[model samples]
Target: MLELLIIACLQDQCREFSKLYDPAEVSLLTCMMSGQSEVARWQAAYPEWQVDRWSCGERSTRAARL
Candidate 1:
């Protein structure tokens, strides 16, 4: 439901979606997709999100340091 709308917003590059939904929700979705191969495409579509790619190893290292 909401996931579909979010995906559609990302695919369509809809700025209005941000106005309608919480920025945190959108940020969460973007972060969830950040590790995927489609990340580059999503990043390009939502440059405002400032998405970054972090491999599992990198995440583990960061978690260990914390």
Candidate 2:
């Protein structure tokens, strides 16, 4: 429902995010942690957006950024 629309927006805006990050997904993760209301809404829509406690000192590894 709303997630699809939000993801579409993210996909469209990915180019902008990718500019600062070689892989824009990093920015996605960081963007979440940046603490905005949208992040919560997004998380509510996608509970799996971030693995439980994934950011607790865990290195991002070489994940393929969507």
Candidate 3:
């Protein structure tokens, strides 16, 4: 599926990025469900970087009702 492909690409990019910059020195913010999983996996792998998750679904729904 397309989602899987995108995740694969992101994982590859992250792997490459990690080679240059220590993951412990970087901060990542993302909204994709897959991205969250990747961050969680990274936490297990690195255990030192900061990862944050935010959802706008409620805000969007409230705006749609206005």
Candidate 4:
């Protein structure tokens, strides 16, 4: 499986949001290719926070979620 990880910050506070995409359906290349648009959509919905960084990785690579 693949995971789309996004890190956003408001002032000095930060939060992470993650969603899983099955490898059977979405490959790593596809995840890498489309991650920016996903992050943009998330940022648009929550304009108060600025996205710090994002990446595609294997599931369970990170622990915190919101």
| lDDT digits (tens) for residues 1-66 of candidate 2 | 001112223333322111133333444455445434544555677664441221212224464446
Q: How many pairs of residues collide in model 2? A: 0
How many clashes (backbone atoms < 3 Å, residues ≥3 apart in a chain or on different chains) does model 4 have?
Answer: 0
1 or 4, greater by TM-score: 4
After superposing candidate 3 on the true structure, give the runs of residues whose Cα lies further than 4 Å from its correct spot.
1-31, 52-66
Query: Which lDDT tens digits does candidate 4 get at residues 1-66?
Result: 689988889999988888689999999999999999988998899999999999998887465454
Per-candidate clashes come to: 0, 0, 0, 0
Where in model 2 is the C-alpha error above 4 Å?
Answer: 1-35, 51-66
CA lDDT of every candidate: 0.36, 0.35, 0.32, 0.88
TM-score of 1: 0.25
Q: Candidate 2's error at 64, in angstroms?
A: 16
Error of 4 at 12 (Å): 1.0
Weakest 10 consecutive residues of candidate 2 by summed lDDT: 1-10
Residue 30 in candidate 4, Cα distance off native in Å: 0.2
lDDT at 48 for candidate 4?
A: 96
lDDT of 2 at 33: 56
Best by TM-score: 4
